[model samples]
Every structure is written in C-alpha cells, then in structure tokens.
Target: MSEEGSSYDWAHKAFLQAFLSKSVMTVDEIKPILAAVMSARDPNRPTLEGDVTAPLISSTIQAINERLTSVDYEIRSTKDQTNKHTVYALVNTTSDSLTQLATTFTPDAIAYIKRVLDCMFETNNTRNREVMAVTSIQASQLAKAPTRSRQSQVGGDEDSSIQAEAAVKSLTIAESEKVLADLFDQDFIYKSRANYYSLAPRALMELRTYLKETYNEPAGDDEDEPAIVRIRDCDICREIVTVGVRCSNRECNVRFHDSCATQYFRSQRGNQRTCPKCKGEWLGDLFVGERAANKGQRRTTGGRSSNVRSEEEEEEDEDE
Candidate 1:
C-alpha cells in the first residue's frame, strides 16, 4: 500500500481527532477513548474484535504518528514524575513560527508562561537546590508586567525600554489565577498536595527539547564534556527525572524515578545498593522536588514519629 493509503484509516483519523481535543492522556484514560472510537465506527462489530487491548492501542498510535510525522507532530509517551503512571502527549516535534501561532494562548499569555517556566526550571532549579517547582503564591506574584530600570533607560535607547515595557501585558491577579486553572485543566501543569506548581507529564514530553536548550549549559571547555543540565534524566529509563531519588553523593548528578530506582536496585547483586556513576551508597530516602523538603522536615523533627519511618519501611514503601 502507498504511504497515503496505509498511514491512516477511519479509526486512525477518529483517534487523532479525539487525542487532539486533550493533547494528553494516560494509558488507562486512552483505553476508553479507543474503545469509544472503535465502537462508534462499527456498532455491529463483535465484542471480542471491538476490545481495545494494549497492543491494539499501541499499533493505532504508531499508525497515527507515522501520518503525523509529515506535520512534525507526534504522540509521545513518558512516565509521570510523581505517580509513575504511563502518559501519552501529542507534541509538536518542531518549534517554529507556525507552531507558535497554533498555540491557544495569546502572545502575552505565552510570555507569562515563559516566566513561570523560568521560575520553576531556572530560578528555583540549581545545583544546590533542585526543587523544580513554584508555590501558588509565587506564581501569582508574577502577574504584574516587568518594569524597566531607570539605568537601562539612561544607558540604552529610551524608546527601546518603553517598547519593551509596552510589549508585556500585565495580567491581574484574578486573570493569573484563571490562566493557572486553565493550564491545570489543559494538563500543561499540575498542583501538588502542598499547592506547589510543577510541569505536568504533557509539558515535560512536549517541551523536553526546549527545556534542555534553555536551561542546560556546558560544564567544561571540551565539546564532549557533559553539560550541567537543569532537567536531569533518569539513570535507569533515561527519561526526564523531575521528582525522583537523587544519588546520596551531593556531587553526583545521578537521578532516578522512584519506581525506576526501586526496579534498578532490585536487580543489583549485593545488598548494598550503589550509584552507577558515583561509588557512594544509594540512599533511597534522598529525594528530589517537594519530597526532599518533606524528608528534611522529618529529619529535623528527630524522632520515630508517624511521619518518620525506618530504612526497612522505606524499602517496603518502594516495593509497594
């Protein structure tokens, strides 16, 4: 069959349309959509044949991606940083003028989003502190338009400063709150129980390239030297690890998702789990993101309270 003929069928087209509506869905969530589409296509089909299995959904997505390649769009899958569930996101492979125009957000809204991303990934994310998240209060504080400094106005063209200030649209606090709520609804960002805002799985998958290019910097003079990356990848699965276990050695940059760390350590020969890069012992309790703060609180409290657990309990929790 020709590329055109084989690439997409009625089912594929329907699935594409359904996926575009949300741009993000988990494996479990996707199963129902697949079933609904398939059943709608042929209501009289046998129940067994109509069944939406994992393999069927995978093959359907594969076909859709093959067609989407021409337009630089793809359905990419990744594990959720917090829950470890599989998630699929329809992402634009290329970031171009056309892609920018296609976004639902206005130019001003996009700029505000960029600032939020900067706060989460650059300002809060550092070698010493890699929180990679912002509180709701902090996000709301960014609603105001950035002001131009008097020195910049005097040193450079005064018109340029005026133009720059005019370019940014100042959103009210209520408007900022609405924008954040919309972002959550669209699955671009997620709020934790602690009310901290972090990039959702869809955002991670969609903006992986952008994040790396913007935040990562070369650590050494040599071209081959690994860059000091703000967004680190899992040592096991190689996916971005925003919320995960970090190597006990502070100098070591090795990180893994909670599940990935558990699975990797399970395969180790000795009882003593060690970091693959650093020779130091792997401390499972050392975590990234907001979990790290909670861990610190537990330590500061200094007792076998309900919040604190033994090493054995930690291992059991990992297994669960």
Candidate 2:
C-alpha cells in the first residue's frame, strides 16, 4: 500500500467507485460525481454543487492517484482531439496490448482490433495524407483481408506463418461491425459523423506509452534526420495530435492541435507565423481530419458560431 493509503477516507473510496463505474469522464461530469459522493457521505453537511472547486477536485484526485499507484491503476486526464475538452479516465498502467484490451475482448476479437489499429496508425496514416482515421468501408474490408506475417526476415519463418494462420479467424462484416460498435461503446474509439473511426481520449490516455512505442520511432532532436515517425505529438501540449494542423513544409513534421495552434500563434508577434521546426511559413489553414475535408467552410474556435472571427483573424486582431 502507498503512504497515502492511510489517509484514504470513505468519501475517497466512494469517489473511486463512482469513477470506476464509468472509467472515463469529463471535468464537468466529474464535478457532479464528486459532489454527489460528498453529499451522500455526510447528509448533515451536504456538499452542494457550488462546493466542488477545481482545487478540491484536483487534491482529491491527487490523493486517489497516490493510493492507486500501489495497485497500478490511475486516474489520468487528456484533451479530446476534436473539442479540446479535458477528459479523465481510470486506466491500467500495464503497457501490453493483451492487458489493455484482453479484459473485455476474446483472442480473435483482439486480433481483429489489432488489425484495425494497424490500418489506422500505419497503413492509412502517412506523411502525404495523415488522415489517422479509418472509414467503416476500410474497416469492413479488413475483415476479409489476410493477416500480414509478423516476421521481418526475407523468408517468412515457421513461427510467423503459424501466427498469421492463428490470427483473427476471417470475421464477417456483421462480426466486424459488432466489434467496432463494442469498441465505441467502451470509449476505446469514437466514430465521427462521416463514419470514420479514431482513437478516443480514453484510449489515448490509457495507451499513450503503447501507441508511442508501437507506432512512433525514437525521438531525435535533429530536424534533418528522416525518422519514420507515424504517431506525432503536438508541439505545444506534447500530447498526440491526430486531428490537428500540420506545418506547411511537408518535410517539417511539427504539428499542433487546432486549439493549441490558436493559442500558440496568438502569442506570436507577426502576421506571418513560422514553423517552430523548419522556420518556414506556417500556413494556419492546413489541417487534418474533418477540418481538412471542409476546407471551403470558415473555421471557428471551440465550435462556436460561424459568425465569430476565425482563429487567424482573431490572432491578427489581437496583434493590432
């Protein structure tokens, strides 16, 4: 047990139980849960909604995490890729794919999921077109596709052939759809309006290390080095930036979350922003995901009214 375990109280336990039930929650969502737990603990001094401050919640989570450290379970937080809203989730610290998804899925289902992930992160995600998402059609096609051998050698080894043969038994379209729906229901992945699937905030938070190690290459400070980096982090927040802006210079891999780019460019002095890496022009317009698809439409911050000034315009206004 951790040193803080002695200080753990009934309220904390109750909060943990509530958090465990959902596994993932937003800051706004957690406030009510904490308030309810506190209110139930002491009816005489019922905790009102107004009583739950950011500091109070932070401290409670801190204490809870301390106790959780001993058990390899933690309540982690990250921003949603689309909306940029903060999200919190109780995650297993174990890094393996088996430990992460095996709790809920069978061996074959897990294999199918692995293939989907491979499509999302590797096959589809590229320098020229960094979609970082898989469409329903693409996912369905994967069900009928043969599993690639794991071996790297020129002649496939016996073990590699065995692994491929034992890989996900050819799932039907219905089975594939069911798996996708289950993943969405569990908050591991989310389906966009266009039927595109990407990693959810909960998955990003829990599988941060796993994704980085599995997809991205070792970090190198040298800008000239042509590293095969599939999964890239935001220049500002250092978190994964799947649906975000990329540098105009294709060679320069610096990318930023739309919200992060707005805040970052707003701080810069000139109208012509420069890439932090290559020092080339930062075309504030270039983007990935839905933003890339809807290039003709005017972009708004935080999904606010379209009448509102664009992020670049707002930055320009502040400069003046």
For TM-score, the strongest prediction is 2
Worst 10 residues of 2 by lDDT: 292-301
Q: How far is candidate 2 from the true structure (C-alpha RMSD, Å)?
A: 8.5
The reply for model 2, stretches above 4 Å from the true place, is 1-6, 145-148, 151-160, 219-226, 290-320
Give the per-residue Cα lDDT of candidate 2 at 136: 90
- For model 1, what is the alpha-carbon lDDT of residue 226? 70
Error of 2 at 252 (Å): 1.1
* Regions more than 4 Å wrong, model 1: 1-7, 39-50, 96-102, 149-158, 219-226, 294-320
* C-alpha local distance difference test of each model: 0.75, 0.77
Cα displacement (angstroms), candidate 1, residue 278, comes to 0.9
TM-score versus the correct structure, for each prediction: 0.81, 0.83
lDDT of 1 at 145: 60
* lDDT string, candidate 1, 230-299, tens digits: 8899988999887888987767889998899889989999899999998789867677776754546223
